[model samples]
Target: MATEKLGIRVERNPPESRLSELGVRQWPKWGCEKSKFPWTYSAKETCYLLQGKVKVYPDGAGGGEEDFVEIAAGDLVVFPKGMSCTWDVAEVVDKHYKFE
Candidate 1:
């Protein structure tokens, strides 16, 4: 019997270019409490939840409010380009993100 390995393509930006183009920004410290933070969307962003839960609100013009979507551990969230939103963290959470 023969088995073939599963293959996947992964693309990464150049470290030097990434560092130069996008300098390191401070990540907010979260705790087991409700917290809201404003964020501007650019290009696109992919996020993976590692711990806790959070709600993302997409920017909307209706009374300065937006739609909310909940995300939790083992969840993948994608925010498309030109989307402005706010992150409402209900519990202490940590996530890994990739932005383009």
Candidate 2:
């Protein structure tokens, strides 16, 4: 008897990220320098670095903002539902992500 490994990739943005004007919600994999977007209350996302680095900042207004969290190769970060933040990729980045 023999066994085999199997896998599949699902690229769909969470409902909140989907625009009503656009019937389908898809976040394709790509490389970029930096990106910024407002996270909706319903969206949840996770990111894994396959090449470069990224800095994540959680939403809040305060005297002193928290330091940026660096995410590089082999690093994983989870953004939960209702969480809002901005993501900045200081170095070119290639990543695999799935949202729901």
Candidate 3:
């Protein structure tokens, strides 16, 4: 699924074969406990969540209830380069990520 305007893309429960094709397991891992933080994507990023729950609010969105996109375990997500946003992590997160 794609989040409008934010340009974030999410693929839920992608097949293992696809993960293997993407070499997701070889990507570096990153994780954090529940928290909220702002971020700016300097480069395009693709990640596969091993576990977690999060909502991403785009820059200038005013953090509105309707302006965020939810993501969680089993999701493969992409953040476009130069996207500024905030992450509201509701559960501990573990993911493999690669920047391009």
Candidate 4:
């Protein structure tokens, strides 16, 4: 699913071959404790979640529950350049990511 307004896209449980094609395992890995933080994407970022759950709220979302996008383990997610948002990590996150 793609959220055009926030320029974020999510692909759930992408095939292993697709992951291999993207060299996902070679991408730098990042992991964080369960927490909430604000983030701004200075460049386009594509990441594949190895484990975790998250809700990303675009800037100016006024803290509305419906304004966030949910992402989870086994999901491939992309955040566009210049997008500013808040990340609410409900579960510890472990992922492989690359900036484009």
Candidate 2 lDDT: 0.51
TM-score of 4: 0.91
> Which has the greatest lDDT?
3
Residue-by-residue lDDT tens digits, candidate 1, 22-60: 332232322345688887766676554557777666666
Cα lDDT tens digits for candidate 3, 60-94 = 76766789889999999999999999999999999
Candidate ordering by TM-score (highest first): 3, 4, 1, 2
User: What are the lDDT figures for the candidates, one per model?
Assistant: 0.54, 0.51, 0.91, 0.90
lDDT of 4 by residue, 1-100 (tens): 4344356798888899999999999999999999999999999999999999999998976777588889999999999899899999999999999999
RMSD per prediction, one decimal? 11.1, 11.8, 1.6, 1.7
Q: Roughly what TM-score does model 1 have, to 2 decimal places?
A: 0.58
Q: What is the RMSD, in Å, between candidate 4 and the native fold over all Cα?
A: 1.7
* Residue 91, model 1, lDDT: 77
Q: Using TM-score, give the best candidate's number.
A: 3
Q: Which residue ranges in model 1 land beyond 4 Å of their true spot?
A: 1-34, 61-66
Per-residue error (Å), model 2, residue 2 = 34
Q: Is candidate 1 or candidate 3 better by TM-score?
A: 3
